[model samples]
Target: MATAVQKITLSSSRDIPFNKLVLSQSNVRRVKAGLSIEELAEDIARRTLLQSLNVRPVLDADGAETGMFEIPAGGRRYRALQLLVKQKRLAKTAPVPCVVRDPATDILAEDDSLAENVQRASLHPLDQFRAFEALREKGKSEEDIAAAFFTSVNVVKQRLRLASVSPALLDVYADDGMSLEQLMAFTVTADQGRQEQLWQAISDSWQKEPYQIRRMLTEKTVRASDRRAVFVGLDAYEAAGGGVLRDLFQSDDGGWLEDVALLDRLVAENLKTEAETIAAEGWKWIEVAIDFPYGHTRGLCELDGMAADLSAEEQGTIEALKAEYARLEADYDGADELPDEVDRRLGEIETALAAFDDRPVIYQPADIARAGVFVGIDAEGTLLVDRGYIRPEDEVPVAEPEQNSDGEPATVAVDGAQPSAAVVQRAVITIGGQVAEPEDEDDDAVKPLPDRLLTELTAERTLALRDKLAITPSVAFQAVLHKFCLDVFSRYSSYGTAMEISVRSASFPVQAQGLKDTPAAKAIDARHKTWEERLPKDRTDLWDWLTALTGDEQAALFAHCASFGVNALYEKGDRYGGGATPHTVEQRIADADRIASAVDLDMVEAGWRPTVESYLGRVPKRRILEAVREGAGKRAAQLIDHLKKGDMAKEAERLLAETGWLPEPLRMAGVDQTATVDATEPEGDREALPEFLAGDDEESPADDADEPHMIAAE
Candidate 1:
């Protein structure tokens, strides 16, 4: 049984005059928001009205329809049109599109207004990004797009960058799978493949922080502030066809240099050029490197050179700069802050004065003939040239008289008879270096046992003596103290000592960036400075100073000095199989372990956290997972095991940060490996993961082989 369908009719629409349309009191919108009336009016002027105004016929008190209508919805558009009219941009009688509802309709004007404002969905950011990209593709410059949208050019560029991300990642973003900040972080890098790869790695992780995303993206790149980059100069690097990655959203401190190898080459070339210029001074040799180990001048003789005299013109310039500096300082003497220009001028004056103060040193020709120079760049990116160092082998030889058996000086024969070839060879060898005297004729005597046998016997005796010394702490201490006393009290280091103890502070030529700023390094430096200030200024007074100290003070000083010689660093073996054999490496670690055990050294207590830059970031995903498993527990390891190498390392850094977990190399023998766990908690409870990590136990789907290698989820 079909009934006739009732037809529905929509309200009639018409172009109402701008003057005839009036604002209704029933309009719900009162507070101002979004674009201003002027901007909206400008937009309407740029591209006519986008939507029709909802209006109703105005009725008199007697129920008669008036000639005008009242707008309930689209009040903003009405105001915009009125503004245009006021500005004489649009006529008062302009035809404004409208939909007229019946004067007697049941719907209230407020209802219509509310419905119009609430029912319309705001555009998604992704849409805006895509729209901007589309505009750019349509032959519009970034400035054009910005002007069209009433935004800054930088904003337009950022949107474009976001749009340029991997389409797959964009899809994920469109699905509300990531935040705007995270999307912005991905724009730090432009490799579409890398963007997709990283997203897949962190998409399921619980710790997908925006900063983590940025760090992972730029981990392999060198920052512009890096010493190497600073030394090579970013402008010059770019001129050499190198690319730089910049972050437009946040301050990147000059961004990052994309081509690290190119930067290194430029740095090397510039350093070599500087070295060549310095070599013009007639140094016997110039040792050039990016950086030298600390205390590199040990055992080298340094020449005492005088600063070069300034030229007449230079002296006048220096005086002028100093006078200018004094005038500026007096002008701003008590001010809270100086004006930028004034401050800048003051800085220039000071620098000019410093140039005069740091005049080049003048060395004697004789010293220059035997001395060498060390050329490298300091941490501040300035060329550092250390001159007048004389190696021991380069020193002038002193003449000595050959004595006869009767204790009188022997004279050389003036006769033409030349010495035998063997005698000549011996004399030539003596000129090269100190040589062993000719062994007394012992061929007839059952020759002192074979040289090799004698060496073996002596080595055995040395081992037995060391074992005995180890048991007698007092004797060992006295022996070390005696060596130190001689070193300090004796004027010449050439004096011989029975104990082969020379406390040479180890230098870390190869180390992580910012190692000097670490807490451990800082504490050691402060301690060294304190001792340096307390020591006697003169070497001759050092013996008296030591004698006046208490026993405890002496022991403290001894320990401090001995600490400098501790060498626990691991260096790679030579590639050609020449140095640092596997056995030697093993032995070094073993000895370090023994020393660590004696001192009860806990690296965790030493403020060594597994940060991304220090440890995790440099290692593989496997090592990161292993660290997490050992430190945080198997559950925490599983949480991030699915992430890519970068994300995995970052997440591992977070999980293991306070756990006090250390790598095997940093762990001491016989120490509890899992001591990082909270001591008050029960042993069984330490494995419980953090609350944030407690989530659906179900494992996420694994990524393909292009992702980091994954362990099977438990």
Candidate 2:
């Protein structure tokens, strides 16, 4: 009789009897040696096994309680339980849930137990390779294996690569604990023969000198042809060998080595011989050319000396050639001169002079002698008389006119009339006066006028008297005198009684004058005074009043005061202080507050309540609570109302459909239930329901195909 089937729960650990758990020998061996076994056990002991174990119960022939179960996967859990038991951490009677299975059924074949094991555990490379082979043998595609094992196709492919590598290398990895990465470098040689050769090379290096294995593998030079041919036929292999040979030795001497010293000496000797020959030929030509009697050095040196005195002979030959070249060049240079027409004109002038009665007199040697005058012609062709005697009577006396009957001297009239002495005197006086005015002025008058007077005048006079103003003036004096005149009479005279009264009323009394005392006056004063106070006292306050006004206020005030000619105030007067218009400042602050409010509201509306809460940390809790209550009462109600009325559910369905969360049928169902139907059909028209009830007619072959007779004819 068969033994009774048992139901049992066991904690995963190495201490669990191996006979009790039905783990594969490969899986059992891997659990015993895996690096993470201890950690997995510790985690299982602490966390009560985060993942449940998948197992199937064994049944006896009699179908009685045997109190035992066979684990389909979760070998790691079994190992962890063994460890826990060894460490005295688990009870032997713990219950584990499992599916019951018939004893005759092949557990690995009936259920994907191995696939589930790989999906859950990090399998060793060797184990994965074996698993991949087993799956492939079972006619499972790589993609199916990948999906079952929760890995990429390429990852499965790489793990399956063990079969492609040399068996010798796989054995080396299994026996010597070689890293999969290091083993991967050898996998590049997929050929059974090449892989075997490479594997032997690696094995020999590892055994004789383990440290040299990495260096040897990295330095291994496989010809491109060989790399390609490893996966192809012998013809490809031979072609690859030919390519390697050609590439390796195409250059002279195979480019493998060069005799550096010999090459260097050869190049140096060729350069030296060429240089010596060039020098010898140069010297021979120089000697032959300089040996002539009529050459440049003929008079300076004899032919023997010419050849021997190299420097002098060389210099003389160069000079002689240069002179001859210059003479030849000068012949062509006349081509650029004036044409013959110009020369003919010059000749005509000479001929005409010769025909004149004067006969174009020339001062010859005899004429100079007869005249008893030594005349010398200078390089410029001007004759110079060194000395000449003059007769006493030959001198012409200076002419003088006798006074007419009117006592006025007889004078030649210019331009039809002799100007009167009085008229001339007046003109001379006017012109002379204008020219001499600045020079003739009193020294005191020439000194610059005070800036006060100059600045207070109209632009016409101000510019006229600009040079008269002081180069530099004290700010206090300029402000009080030039801009704010103290003399009431002068102010009244320039701007009339009304403006003078206004200025006088705004001004401070001489003894009591100060900024505070003239509050209204200072407020209206140019804004430059504030900048001046910030600066050293030496600087001028030119733009004070203008700076105090905002752009709009300035424009408005300019427009308003234009009729009264108040623009001249800024043109002539210096500024006194700085301040912006109240309107503009308040407007800017309000605009900033609006922008900040908008941003704060945006954050709050966007579900950034936490950020808003952080910023309102300084706000009173009661005020915050009040604000939230108000927002909930109004905005929340409105939002809910909007969501209820709007097709938000439909929109959500659409979004879900787009993201593939909702399948096509569910999405279409939602649309059919929510969307309106066509009104053209009667409300009770059951005939329209045929298409919907009959499924899609377009996809049905009976509806799509032609009649049998029509098909046969075609």
Error of 1 at 19 (Å): 3.9
lDDT of each: 0.69, 0.35
Q: Taking the tens digit of each residue's C-alpha lDDT, what string does model 1 give over 335-376? A: 999999999998888787877788788998656656788877
Candidate 2 — which residues are off by over 4 angstroms? 1-124, 202-714
User: Judged by lDDT against the true structure, how good is candidate 2?
Assistant: 0.35
Those runs of model 1 whose alpha carbons end farther than 4 Å from true positions after fitting are 30-32, 58-60, 64-69, 82-95, 168-189, 193-220, 247-256, 324-352, 380-382, 397-608, 611-650, 657-714
Work out the TM-score per prediction.
Answer: 0.64, 0.18
lDDT of 2 by residue, 587-608 (tens): 3223222222322212112211
* Candidate maximizing lDDT: 1
